[model samples]
Target: MKPRFYDLSMPLSEKTAPFPLDTPFSRVETMRMEDGDACNVTVITMSVHVGTHVDAPYHYDEQGLRIDEVALERYIGKANVFTVYPREVDGIPIITADDVRELSISAERVLLHTETYPEYAAFHANFASIEPDAIDVLAERGVRLIGVDVPSVDKATSKTLPAHKRCREREILILENLRLEHVPDGDYELIALPLRIAGGDASPVRAVLRMYAETKDMT
Candidate 1:
């Protein structure tokens, strides 16, 4: 059976929103063919965490592995996709441990589709975030990697980053700012690899998902 593929990466450009105080995505035409240059060359500048990106263990754990040191196998494998709309808890939209426990995950990688922060043009401060307990629940369920549609697993205003710390302690990978609104919940093969940036904390990825289905006879 052939499989259907879904792109889970955001389009990076000047319009892509950056994290609060982080560098925005930008591109400059260094050599435009229209300007009589030999070829069209463009230069881009942005934070590694700007678009759909994977965080290395070093992102939170000072003694953890860097982006180049992580095994590529972790970024490519079977993954479970689930959707969760956070509920208001103490005036904040949060995915709790109870919420994570409700998901019937059968894969090492789990992607959550929360409709919050649905666009790349602007930054939203109140996007749904995951709690530390939720991270713990995912870890206990044998989830090695976790993906979220929102920009972060922790609150936008959080300084301590409890959720991120918890994931670090659990040795779970994190993929943030994924484009998951169009993707449905199911088990799929996920391929989201980060660049081998030496000593980098995070790197944007061209994330994709493949779902198996019955083949149709064109007779």
Candidate 2:
């Protein structure tokens, strides 16, 4: 049977809202056929952390590997999607270690559906984020990668970014800003390759998931 594919990436455009103080996506038309140019050409500019993207260890650690240095295998493989609704703690929604422990982690790559930052064109600062203890739980379970539906793994107002730092220390790759609202909770093959940007701390990715009939019950 042919596998079904689901796009788990945010639609990147000029209106695609970026994180606070980060660069928004923009495009410039250098040549237009309507303007008598031979062909249409455009240039795009945006922060690597914009939209659906993967964060390299270097994003939080000075001695961490760059985006280009990380192995590609870490981004592509079988993954599990789980929906989690975190409760507010001190006016901030957080996914705690208990929340993670409740889920049956069957894959090396785990994508959490928080549905907090649902709108791609709207930047919501109060979106939910994973806690450092949750990161430790995933790492202890041998999870190599952690993906989320929000722009960050830590709270928007975080100064220390404990979750990001814990992930770096655990050597767990991170994929953030994923559009996982439509994806069901199950196992699927994930493909979210980052660009080979030299010395980059992060890179935008076209994340997707493949559903197979035979593997639906495997998890």
Candidate 3:
């Protein structure tokens, strides 16, 4: 049987919610067929971290690798999807290390479906964020990349961004704002390659997952 693919990326548009104070997606038509132009042409402007995207290590560390410098292999490989419910401590939703420890992390890439930031046009400040200890646990489990269903790995009000820093320290890449609501929890082949932006701290990605079957041995 042919393998099936699931799109795990959020649609980028003017209505797509961006990180607080970050640039939202916008398009300006340079040429239009309706306006007596030969063809339609547009200029897009948005933050690299907008919508579904990957955060290169340089996003946090000054000496870290840029988006173009990161290996493509890190973004494409076997990945495990784990659904984690939100738990609040002191009125803040967080994905604790204990939550990560309960997961069967058999792959180098892990996508956590928190269902916190479910609406693309609405920004939720209380979206679940992965704790720094959770990052440590994932790193110890040989996880090379972490993907989430929220705009960021750290809390919205976090200034220091401990989770992001820990990921950088562990050399783990990050994919944020993934659309995992329709994707069931299981193993899949992930292909979420970031754009090769020179000296970019981060880059948008068109993330997708291919259904993995054990009989076919699709990795």
Candidate 4:
């Protein structure tokens, strides 16, 4: 039987919601067949974090690796999906350490399905965020990479970014803005390699997941 797959990345376009104060996606046609050009050509402008993207340690640490410098192996591997329905406080939901420890995740990379930021058309300040201790719990369980359905692991209004700092300290990679609402909880092989942008803090990635049966024999 043919294998099943799921695309976890959000679609990138002019309407995609970007982190506040970051660049929004825009395109300008530089040349087109109708304009007598040989072929269609356009220029795009947007933040690296505009869509589903991976963050290198450079995103928060001054001496950390850049997007191009981070190993590709970190993005492609067995990944477990853990879902924790939100329980909000002050209009924001937080995933605590206990929330992650209670799950029987057995992968080095894991994606959190919080059902926050359900749509890509708008940015909401009340989306779910993870606590720093939760990062520690994931690290204790041998997680090397973390993915979230929300825009950032920290709250939208966060300035200190404790969660990001903890990830930086733990040397864990981060993939954010994933579209995982329709994906069920389970183990799968992830293939979400980021762009090799030199000196970049982050890069947009096309996150994909293959069924466990398709990758069980793979190394």
For all the candidates, what are their Cα RMSDs to the real structure?
3.5, 2.6, 1.8, 1.3
Query: Can you rank all candidates by TM-score, best first?
Result: 4, 3, 2, 1
lDDT value for model 4:
0.91
Residue-pair clashes per prediction, in order, are 0, 0, 0, 0
For model 4, the run of ten residues with the poorest summed lDDT? 83-92
TM-score of each: 0.94, 0.95, 0.96, 0.97
Model 4: which residue pairs collide?
none
Query: Candidates' lDDT values, in order?
Result: 0.89, 0.91, 0.92, 0.91
Query: Which ranges of candidate 4 are over 4 A from the true structure?
Result: 1-3
Best by TM-score: 4
Model 2 clashing-pair count? 0
Error of 3 at 88 (Å): 0.3
Residue 83, model 4: lDDT of: 90
Model 2 C-alpha RMSD vs. true structure (Å) is 2.6
**lDDT per residue, candidate 1, 1-219, as tens digits?**
343789999999888999989999989999999999999999999999999999888888889899999999999888999988789977779998999899998989999998988777899888888989999989989999999998999999999989888989998999999998788788888899999899999999999997733212212
> Could you tell me the lDDT of residue 117 within candidate 4?
85
Q: Give a tens-digit lDDT track for model 4, residues 1-219.
A: 443899998988988989999999999999999989999999999999999999989899899999999989999989999899766777679998888889897999999999878988898888899999989999999999999999999999999999999998888889999999878899999999988899999999999999987779977
* lDDT, candidate 3, 69-170, per-residue tens: 999999988899999986998888899999999899999999999988889898889899999899999999999899999999999999999999999888
- In the range 127-194, model 2's lDDT, one tens digit per residue, is 89888899999999999999999999999989999999999888899999999888889889899999
Error of 3 at 28 (Å): 1.0
